[model samples]
Target: MRKPENESRTKTIKAMYTQIVNELRARILSGELTQGSRIATEYEIAQQYHVSRGTVRQALGELTREGLLERVQGSGTFVRSSVHTHEAETSLPAQKNIGVILSHATDELNMRLLRGIEQAARSRGYQVIFAYSEENDQLLARDIASLQMTTAGLILFPLSNRSIDSTIVRLKQVGFPVVLVDRYLADMDNDYVVSDNVGGGYRATEHLAILGHTRIGFAYSRAGDLRTTSVRDRWEGYRKALYEYQRPFDDSLILADLPTDAEPDTDLFDALIRRPDLPSAIFAVNDWVALEFIKAATRTGVRIPEDVAIVGFDDLSYDEHLSVPLTSIAQQGIAMGMHAATLLINRIEKHVLGEPKHIVLPTQLIVRQSCGARLQVLRAPDEKPS
Candidate 1:
């Protein structure tokens, strides 16, 4: 006995509705359709997918019931904010598996941090599961969701873009145990371990000043609101150092809007090279940027330490191996990771509670050839008791 045509048609329509629901759910979870953002109207979705309005309605209805979407009386469907959701049940198993999420695991700084995390976790009989977000919000959200289901707790090294604040807040609101590493969201009460970026910046600037390089530029990669807390703190430190040295803080000396890993903005570099009033020295936000700037400057016949000097933060191991050994601020990446991991484990074990703790680790200044400090020392030795 063959099934009725109407029954077959009904099953096909239901499957279409389910497919729509899954697609929308994926968008919401991946942050393509962000929290409180409006989704396409029923007619728009129906027309786009070549499905009936009734099918779209059924898909939206399913999302609404699952607490993933909300529909207002006068407004269209919106992604539901995670704040109103019920508290997530703690589902950590006895295996003591911990999850680590980082922007880039392959980066040297991050690798050092991971080494520390692994050491600490193993010593304490805990296992670690690492995930790389590649600084993508969608990948980060997916990693977070997966970790939430299986790990005892999470240690996150958030991206500098600051797009993960809402997600982090949601996790906190749901009583998820997490410790942030390297960077933190401003005004959010959360556990974090960070380097003393301001002090590092100050040290970098002060070193240049000590080498008689009063005119120093601050070079950064990010522009506008994309600036990270570390960069901001470093800038503050630079300002403070200038104030202490009684040197005028020239706004023109600050050069942001540089190229990022995704977008190559060569114009910014050209502008820096062509600037009428170039600083005698530069304090880069990090070693990588310093290296790039040095390479660019050298190619343009800029004599380092004679025409310009450079200092960088995050005294990476390879800094010394550069053509001109870079002066930098040494951040203890491994220690930071160990501390963050320990903090998370303590929280998971209910050892700490109440107000979230914020740990600011100290930074050290490393003097090298690039900042012209070594030249100053040699010149001092050659001086005949001035």
Candidate 2:
């Protein structure tokens, strides 16, 4: 069970108060709250932050003095429009350039997102400036800020492990236009477009359950993955499906922080071959993770579906070509890109001046031979794959 919100709020008043200030300030400057947008009531704010109404009022008072917000006697409080105009005012007119920062450039994630972004940007006669952050280097945020300097707005796919940068905070404070793709910061209100990871996960797990596999495993690449929204949401979906299907949620069935290598002695690889009552089916965090699992299991003489089954997220292009075509969930990357780019452009062009938009595209399950859907090779829970 999770601790009550008030339980954690006892840490420090200064800490909580300042944190609320920063969060609200980010929303205001990021154009999430927007100029003239009425913010939550004091009671609402107090409840949200699990603080006293007096503390909420104090925070609002500070913002009011800073000229980010104003009090309307009958209507509560609102973000100041003039502040948005003044802070976001650039001497030059908005540029026709859109900046894009992605995690990888070689995969279909690139191809699809770019295709959608290009299609939308082209319609508006905007040029795209692109960069990738495969190394997860310190220079990433700097590169994005630099891109912003050259373009009218930005579309970003941030590295999961990295914290929000001071530069990003400054950009939002100035009401600079940006739209996040794939994932978003939980504490900050930023416009974003993402796939329905939780729903996708539930569907994937449910598919395995429907196939008569009671023992299912979930694979993740890192111990810190739960901190990442996509991974956490998917895991939540897995648990939800387990509950719905009346399957036990077993910790031993989970394989996490797996070595990012193919060498022997890997926990995931060795466990499948040596462990008794190994899960008859597996749900991988993503297609790549699924592929790795398949390789490891097959190398140890585990027959696909006939012995064990596997399902993965992200129905990648090559899934169909593998010896065992992967059954997976598909994300609308292209649509995500289009939505993000278009939203950013609208903000840049002053077409939208309302609250931040969070768009979640639906996910689809692509069935193949790997999940044992057609093979019907489910074994008893106690039986070992042979």
User: Which predicted model would earn the best TM-score?
Assistant: 1
Clashing residue pairs, candidate 1?
none
Q: Write the per-residue lDDT of candidate 1 for residues 132-189, one digit (tens) a residue.
A: 7877789888889987877888999877755347778889989989999988876576
> What is the lDDT of every predicted structure here?
0.77, 0.77
List residue ranges in candidate 2 displaced over 4 A: 1-94, 135-137, 162-165, 261-274, 377-386
lDDT of 2 by residue, 57-88 (tens): 99999889767799998989999865432124
If scored against the real structure, what TM-score would every candidate get?
A: 0.72, 0.70
Off by over 4 Å in 1: 1-95, 223-226, 262-271, 379-386
